[model samples]
Target: MLVHENLARLLQSYLSAGLRSWVQINVRSTNQFTYSEFTQLLPNPTITLSFKINPLPGICLLEISHNVAFAIVERVFGGPGSDAQPQRELTEIELGIIQRVVRDTFGPMKEAWRNVAEIDPSIEAVETNPVFIQTGGPTEVVAAITLAVEIGEHLGHMTYAYPYSTVEPVLSRLSPQSWLADAKHMSPSEEDSLRRAVQGAPLPLTTLLGKTRIRLGEFLALGVGDLVRLNTRVGSELPVFVGNKLVFHGKPGVVGDRMAVQITRRGT
Candidate 1:
């Protein structure tokens, strides 16, 4: 259940996008967890959605607090979306709306994980009692993400949990480093943006024409315009360095009135 931090970021983006599309409201994922920790975070009387993720052996859960769920239902009915304290079970219409929310959210959830996994997430059931819906055992680990949803005048939380057993199949592909490396190659626009940003950076370039050993006494005796013999031949290739690191072999030359180094070999 040790999810890559990049995966958390990806989920956040998709969750925000998915929620906005369905309700036309803001939803921000502000927290995350591994399954073992998630069990302790669950609140009583919340709406728990169990999902059967195909090809993965276990169930995943998405939980929404009553306040947030009621607010969403109220808003969908063109109400003012104020906070609601639901003391009773949801009505049939409310349940339908909640189901729609779950179904709509799956698109972005699946999209976010497309790179790491092609998860087919479908709702198995919706429950009000956390005791009845077992996300995992007390010590079981899972990847979990929490969202802060805004509806009209209220803000509430929604949490999603995917058990470690369920995600183990694709865990290797979810490493943050690997994901970043893949992202760099997958998006040409991102590559261009990176290149453009680095293009303006200034580096100190130096061409070492030659080197010679000399005593301190001989060095101090030197004067301006004095000819000092070098260890290199006139036609030899010089080593070119950028910030003290040798990057190329070049030949010292004159370019249109300016002294320059014509690169002959690039570094490995």
Candidate 2:
């Protein structure tokens, strides 16, 4: 039960605040910790981040499943589908991306620790390895990112080993207490104002008729019957350029016989 609660908190940390999406963690294997192994009963692929405090040689592993990893990567890449398989083996580029993500997710916690404990936490990437496990008699593979945190040379070579289960209690103790416990206590006025702002945001008015060019002599000779060719192909969504930047891609339309455009997608 403690393991489940810790896993729940870990999942919440990743889903709500870390990756900002719903995710699940399934622990598929374990060596010594039974409470830690309970997470393997879940149905998601697990990722374990192992951390070692200097001189200990021992490590603490934070395990999360593969499904969660793919979900996180997809979210960061602004892609769809959480089940997409990562191509090839883990490369340095992929490891770097994962490191940045971990840093981003844990930056606040690290900052909080720095402020309170005055301990300078150093995170180092030791390895990004793949582990295979059998779940319900089915084989599953997961990619694990290992990081080492050196708290101090002393604590005398002591390995502060904490599973997701053990660390969860520590996390709970550190969680902030909210005075506004009810939704009713929150400011509805701010919500209404934000909604209004979103609704009132101005729509792009600029339109693109596609690329055009005119020679000096041609421009001088231009008259009412002069025809200018635009580079855009027919039936193609025109790119609306605003402030010389492509902002919207849309199909030309007509509103009450006046030329208009139905925006299809926004371009950043």
Candidate 3:
């Protein structure tokens, strides 16, 4: 769970944005469970979907309740998205609606998974009963994310399960810290964009009037009006520093009412 907390949060954000754009619905992550524990939590007559990840040769499961499916179907068809749970399996129209929802979800799902690996998931089949599906062995370990979906006034649960084997090859990249560390290396375009962004940023500049060491007692006894003699003469060009780096040489003078430095030479 320690390693997954960050990934979970990132996935939650991606899914939230994806669903909001596609269906105008909101989703919140309630909890996570292991595969064995999650299977035991499935309700009877569950809407089970088997998904296949291309180029990885792996399968996963997606589950939603009948109530949630019905609500989504209603909303997709320009209805109020409120109704009693249907007693039968999804009809052709309902299935068609759900298929679109599933297809749209893959975009964000793949993007959230990019930190781990590039996967293309497609729903192979949808089954009403979990007993009829066999995406993996009964004992296979998986990470299941439980989501609280809100469609109108009805609230429903949706679960997404990913088998450990499916993402094992890229597990090292899945950690949030690792993913963020990798993000620190920017592409040339990104670097250029960032450089442009900070080009106008302000910097503090200071002139080196000169420095002279004094005894601790002598410095402590200095008075407000006392003058401390410096090593440089009054008319000598002063080295200018920008945040500690000496970048220019300037001559000090009084401009209008304030003292100023006019740049005379650039740093070598």
Candidate 4:
């Protein structure tokens, strides 16, 4: 129990800080099963993240329950993380959102395992289906750690499966003693962390003024300040985007010295 509790406390600190939410993690059960048995235990439509520890030989897995995934999605979109647990798998957009969080969620493993061995946990892939995942031979031992994940009023589960080959080298020093809370009062990372997580990423603001087709002769003959009619009507709203996503429509304007766009409406 102490072992589980210590690891839980460690993860609680990391997740709370990264997500900026009150998250409680308690290890529900721990086991060592054969790889074949491990496959049987996975939920089909789960968040299966494949990762590897530097200096270790095999890929490892961490499966998150759907409830937790959906809750994270809702919270990131400016809603309370508590939502009705759905029976279906996550959508493409939902998967992308969780993938970002998962990347952040696992990066701290290297810190937690520093005493055991200097290792790095790098997420290799995220999949909803586990059909093609392979961590080790069918008969190899797999250590599984299942935790009860809670955020607000919603509750779910997360299971981590580490193959023997991956953790064997560090087994001697892997102990709950190494994972005790660094701070007695570890608080959630800055207020509204989810909002800041997304806001910090750089976004390109590209404007599409108009479109037109020109023949070889016409395009070749174009000169500076030449007038060319466009498909769009004058004074029409221009489309502003980030990559392929249309974020908004705006009208062109100028302020003292800089040309700018005044958003007319949000994109659909």
Candidates in order, TM-scores: namely 0.56, 0.33, 0.58, 0.61
Of 2 and 3, the candidate ahead on lDDT is 3
Residue pairs in clash, model 4: none
Local distance difference test, candidate 3: 0.68
Report the CA-based lDDT of candidate 4 relative to the real structure.
0.74
The runs of at least 3 residues in candidate 1 whose Cα sits more than 4 Å from the true structure, single-residue gaps closed, are 1-41, 83-87, 136-138, 184-268
For 37-155, candidate 1 gives per-residue lDDT tens digits of: 66556766558888976767888888887777887677667676445565776887798899897787676566556566677889988877666776656667766666555544566
Given candidate 1, what's the lDDT at residue 39?
Answer: 53
Question: What TM-score does prediction 4 earn?
Answer: 0.61
Cα deviation of 21 in candidate 4 (Å)? 2.7
Report how far residue 168 has shifted in candidate 3, in Å.
Answer: 0.8
* Model 3: worst 10 consecutive residues (lDDT sum): 1-10
Checking candidate 2 for backbone clashes, the offending pairs are: 27-39, 27-40, 45-65, 45-66, 46-64, 46-65, 46-66, 47-64, 47-65
lDDT of each: 0.67, 0.43, 0.68, 0.74
Which parts of model 3 have CA positions greater than 4 angstroms off? Answer: 1-37, 186-268
**Lowest lDDT block of 10, candidate 1:** 1-10
Residue 127's lDDT within candidate 4 is 81
TM-score ranking of the models: 4, 3, 1, 2
**lDDT tens digits, residues 1-268, model 3?**
2223333333344544544422222234535455666667777777778898776656788898777788777666666544566677788778777877877777656644554556788889887666677767667778776655555556676677878787677777766477457657856654443344235334789998999999999999999999999999988999999999999999999999999999999976
Those runs of model 4 whose alpha carbons end farther than 4 Å from true positions after fitting are 1-4, 175-268
